[model samples]
Target: MESGNSIHQKPVFWQESMPELRPCHNRTVTAQRTYGGISAAERRAGRRAALLDAALEIIGTQGVDKLTVAGLCAQAGLNERYYYEQFTGRDAVLTALFDGIAEELASAIVQALQEVAGGSAADTPSAARENAANPSARRMRPETRTMAHAAVAAGIHVLTDDPRKAQVALAVSASTPELRSRTLQTIASFANLVAARGIDFYALSTPTPDPAIGFRATYLVGGLVQTLTSWLQGDIDMTREQLIDETTDVFVLLGEDLAQRLR
Candidate 1:
């Protein structure tokens, strides 16, 4: 079989593709305005944002199936009547929540890459002088390795930081194509930066079609998401730093020549 097609007749992200988020899944009732001195308009907006946040937290923790308007109200402590005031149904909330997650992940990736680049930058004048003196002693950018570590660290930090969202993003990957695509797209974008270092990333990202590189990429991305998620869930004993180090090592082993430039 194909690599992304299931090695041993196993499915990949099939259940998550169906956009299950809805108003009815939320069992919680939205509470009325609690703050003492807020305007009616302000209170309405606050309640709306709160409901959205509650929906994300719920979806991020429990699977999409649990993301009903009632559930959102319960989680946000808003009355059931307030749900329709902002959103039409669970799908609307899911769209908003998913969009939020994507933005968060993108920001995290950019930040991580920045950290790694910053960490890699070292000497200015003296390093140049040294490089001038020795031809083959090409000084690695101080930010290179730092970027590698930072990329891995940032992802882990985000996943482990929130127990509920962590599970939602991680375990849910095994069933939902939508979630999987959102995540893989993020991973692929990150990989692309590294992949751009070479003109032939398409060819070199894998060994042979006989070996199924597409599946390999999926496995790596999925494993990265799930592993960090598991760590956050307390299923794994390794530290975030340890996981970062180990994962970087794994990238090196699999990415062959491509992983080095990312470092």
Candidate 2:
């Protein structure tokens, strides 16, 4: 402290006290910045959503052939960097969009079933007790038909609520081998869910190991998809209510018939 050379000396106390002043090559300080009251994460999510929506529009109109990285970014009103931020490629975007639609449809169907089953806390205790006392008798007739109608209506509503989404999910999927494969996988997954739900709802004695349930479930779900696709393409002229009613009839017929066989 007395010599001029002391001015160049390292201050150990200062270094120890202000450790943050040290140069750390590995330390990364990420500053989260917000723009227009929106956080960085929120902005990223919005960009991804915008990209997906743009992908849907392109695929729904010009088909998958037009779904290029450049084209998608242009459609989304985003830079190419933003497209890469969210997806690896055009196929990735397509898959994300399709999966989102499938998830939404699945959720809608499940909610519809729950509503029909009166699973809400708002449901009357008397009604619950009645169903509990004779679940088999209650669930077999009126409950079956009501559940069928609700589920079919809900699924149809989801698809029809956005025809562009329907087009992308149903028609556009068939345009590519990758999407077609995914479509099959999705069908099988939904079929499995249908089989499981049927067994539980009807209390069927049919062993889960049996192939009959799988076969029936696949047939029903696959047929339903085909029927809906036909309707969307205007190949089927019936009204939406007529379609739901008819579909519910088929569901009841097959479900009851299978339940009887399993019993």
Candidate 3:
């Protein structure tokens, strides 16, 4: 929960740990140029990915305070010169890493929603289909619990399967000013998305939209992020399945309440 300019300041523990570079030779030059017959750009991208992975590892275990350029390059098994090929500095790399995780989480949710929508469409009753244009007509629709379960499971699985990703996205991202800002922005984007989808699902029309809808969506997003962060940091003692079930239940109940209020 760190904030402000102080989060960007380097701590006393930020020490250089660059590994000694190997001596260059004609053989090494030739090998690097044609390594696996891949282009130089591809090789550089591979090295960048390796460095990001190393950064995630360090941030997760040793903390962001120890994430020096030298240590990152050394852990990535790349030369110091190569680090600059992709990122300007450690902060840039950290930003990119968080962005990548946010994209992954967003994609998982979208995919889950798409699957749920497809199933719901296929199972719709003929009468409901005919009355699609009747604003006053209510249909026997599929419960959103299935969608909630799918989305929650998809998001949680992405984190649990990769501890490094979980740590970087949920814990380390909140430890810096730049990263914390990015995380909050990402959360807001997700909150907006959820609110939009809720409106569409419930067909709730308001000449002056209820401010409570936005507030509720933001509250849900914040709660979910904090809960997942605690679980990832081992502050919560529930099993993965238990966590998914409980979270899905909360989301389903929230959706049901919203629907009732709209009605």
How many residue pairs clash in each candidate at the backbone level?
30, 0, 0
The model with the greater lDDT, 2 or 3, is 2
lDDT at residue 131 of model 2 (Cα atoms): 45
The residue pairs in collision within model 3 are none
RMSD of 1: 11.9
lDDT of 3 by residue, 1-263 (tens): 11011122222212232333445664323333456788665766677778888888898787777888899999999999888767777777777677666667777887877876776643445324323532222322334555566677888887778777777775545677877787787778878777877887788777866787788888887898889888876899999877876787677567667779877
Maximum-TM-score candidate: 2
RMSD (Cα, Å) of model 3: 10.1
lDDT of 2 at 108: 80
Off-target runs (Cα >4 Å) in candidate 1 are 1-45, 59-66, 79-82, 118-143, 171-190, 193-219, 229-235, 252-256, 259-263
Model 2: how far is 254 from its true place, Å? 0.8
lDDT of 1 by residue, 165-221 (tens): 555455445445665565566565544444442224224434333233444455566
- In order of appearance, the predictions have TM-scores of 0.56, 0.77, 0.73
Off by over 4 Å in 2: 1-26, 119-140, 205-209
Ranked by lDDT from best down, the candidates are: 2, 3, 1
